[model samples]
Target: MIRAWKRFAAYVLISLAILVGMDMARADAGSTVAPAAGPGDAARSWAGHIAALRARA
Candidate 1:
């Protein structure tokens, strides 16, 4: 009935909000952990490595 549908909608909205929040958190954390610029390619390589590690976790 209408009541059940309303409950279902609320659950879906809450789940979506949680997912978005987690994604935003990950992005924020990654930005903070990013390596700084260097003279050569080493910094870029390290950044990619760190990103890969994060994705795995």
Candidate 2:
């Protein structure tokens, strides 16, 4: 009975470790395409525009 319990514990621990490793690997593998940060990004930032307008006033 003790032997069976030991084996069960080992299996559970190994399974958990494998799951954690897979999650870490998945996080490292970022999306294939990078997000678009094109030249007009700054131009489209409404908050910055508002701040500029406020500063001018």
Candidate 3:
């Protein structure tokens, strides 16, 4: 029983470590791109068109 408990604990710690490493990797992978107003403006325009179509429905 003790041996089983030890193995379980080890597995849990290793899993947690792997998850933390993945999270760190993802954070580091995040974009460094500067935000532009053009994309937001385009999206807003598209959304307005969609809303208009939805209103017709």
Listed per model in order, the count of residue pairs whose N, CA or C atoms clash below 3 Å is 0, 0, 0
lDDT by residue for model 2 (1-57), tens: 999999999999999997665444434543232334875753444344455445545
Is candidate 2 or 3 superior in TM-score? 3
Cα-based RMSD of candidate 2: 16.9
Question: What TM-score would each prediction reach against the true structure?
Answer: 0.53, 0.52, 0.52
- Best candidate according to lDDT: 1
TM-score of 3: 0.52
Extract clashing residue pairs from model 2. Answer: none
Worst 10 residues of 2 by lDDT: 26-35
Task: For model 3, name the residue pairs that clash.
Answer: none
